[model samples]
Target: MRFALNHIATPKLSLADFLGLARRLGMPAIEIRNDLPDVVGTMPAGAVRAAAVASGVDILSINALYPFNVWSGDVPARALALVDYAQACGARALVMCPLNDGTPVPHGDLVAALRELVPILRQYGITGLVEPLGFPVSSLRTKREAIEAIREAGASDVCKLVHDTFHHHL
Candidate 1:
């Protein structure tokens, strides 16, 4: 299996430096994050894409489009923006994360959100890696829940579950 480095593992490094590190380490895949310092909103998509290309690393995915299970309150707009960025940056997928607040999102709502997101993802030619956050307060906290929602939404072709090892034991 090919191992990919998550940007969280080296938050202090600049994206260019991080890409260099990944290249030196022979890791072919890396996940970019909006949460990282001096990255995301601060940098241009072409810059990020160029750095990855220069280092010969594939951007496996963008770390997240958060609170994705909630389709309201600007989430749809954010999803489109992220997908646009991912496509422009040469990233293969966008990681879709669920609500992490204590509030619960209904199962029907979750499936509905995925259904709406699938068409957008397809239009962008990007995969959605549905990551169910494993936190006590997280609305969708397990892969099974994510899987069920994807199946219910008939979004199997557009996305798949992203099982985080840290969240698995949580």
Candidate 2:
């Protein structure tokens, strides 16, 4: 089995340094974040691609796009931008996380959002990984829900769930 380090595990490191750490650890891949160090916000996609290539580590993914089930206001824009970035940076996928603020999102809404995102992901040749947050207040709390939603949205080909063990056991 292969293991990849996530940027959140070492939030203090610079992108270059973080990639270096992955290489030093013999990890062939690393997950960068848009939140912890805000790699997506602070650096251009080309730079991210360059750093990953220079270090010989694959960029597994960008940590996430939050509240992806909402599908309104700035969410669509954020999804588009992140998808674009993932494509440009040679990342394989974008993690789509649900809202975690004690609000419930209807199953239809969740499927609708996933449907809306399919074209964008396909356009950029990027995969959408639905990571169900298992927090008490999270709208999506189980992989089952994400899977159903993905199936309902007809996004099975382009979308998949992220089985985060910590969240699963939460």
Candidate 3:
């Protein structure tokens, strides 16, 4: 099986050091995180792009655009910004995680969000990797619901699922 490091595993490492670690470990790809301190946090997109090129490690995705299924207000703006960042950094996809905060977002609303994002992702030449949270409080607690939303949105070509083993066991 192939392996890619998620930056969350080493939140303390500088991007350079993290890339070095990936190279040292023979990993061709890595998932950078915005949630981690000083990782993708406030780094200029071009610098991140240059760092990826210098390190010779492919960025799998900007792991992630959070609460992506909630499509209105600031969410769309943030998603577009993340997509631009993903494209700029030569990442193949944007890891789109659903709202996990107990409160349920309607099924139709989720599908609508996917349909809305599908075109933006395609326009930026990036894929959207939907990662369902299986925690009891998660709004979309299973991959089945995410799959149904994708299907209903007719976005299979532009989107895919990230099967998080830890979440699967939840």
Candidate 4:
């Protein structure tokens, strides 16, 4: 497997500096979290793309679009915008995180949400990495649930899972 460094590992660094460190560490890829300081969400697309090219580091994915298994009025549009940004930054995927804090949405609803989001992801040639948060309150607490949702949505072709070790072990 390819080693990928996440922006959370060096939260204080600028995007340029982070990519430089990934290159220095000989990591083939890096993941950028929009929540991280001085990363993609805070920087322009040109700068992010330039930093990746300059450091020769591939962008594996964007850290996340949260509560992606539910849809509100603006949620879909926001997801689309992030997908566009990911494509522009040359990232291969956009991470989709499920609802946390015990929202208790039904599995069918979750699957419906994925179905709604999948075509949007395909529009930009991006893959949706469905991440199951194992927190006590998370709606999706296991990979199996995420897989079920993906299958139900008929999004197997466009969606994959993000197995986070901390969440997995919890």
Candidate with top lDDT is: 2
Better of 3 and 4 by lDDT: 3
**Candidate 2 lDDT for residue 107:** 90
Error of 2 at 77 (Å): 0.5
**Higher-TM-score candidate of 1 and 2:** 2
lDDT per residue for candidate 2 within 1-170, as digits (tens), equals: 78989999999999999999999999999998899889999999999999999999999898899989999999999999999999999899999999999999999999999999999999999999999988989999988989999999999999988988877676
Error of 3 at 86 (Å): 0.5
**Better candidate number, 1 or 3, judged by TM-score:** 1
- TM-score winner among the candidates? 2
Model 1 local distance difference test score: 0.91
TM-score of 3: 0.95
Poorly placed runs, candidate 4 (over 4 Å): none
Give, for candidate 2, the lowest lDDT window spanning 10 residues. Answer: 161-170
Candidate 3 weakest ten by summed lDDT:
33-42
Alpha-carbon TM-score of each model against the true structure = 0.96, 0.97, 0.95, 0.95
- Tens digits of per-residue lDDT for model 4, 50-117: 88988899999997888788887777887998899999989999999988889887898889889899
RMSD of 2: 0.9
Task: Tell me the lDDT of candidate 4.
Answer: 0.87
The digit string of per-residue lDDT tens for model 1 on 34-140 reads 87653678889998899889889999899788889999999999999999999999999999999898999999999999999999999999999999888989999
Global lDDT of each candidate: 0.91, 0.93, 0.88, 0.87
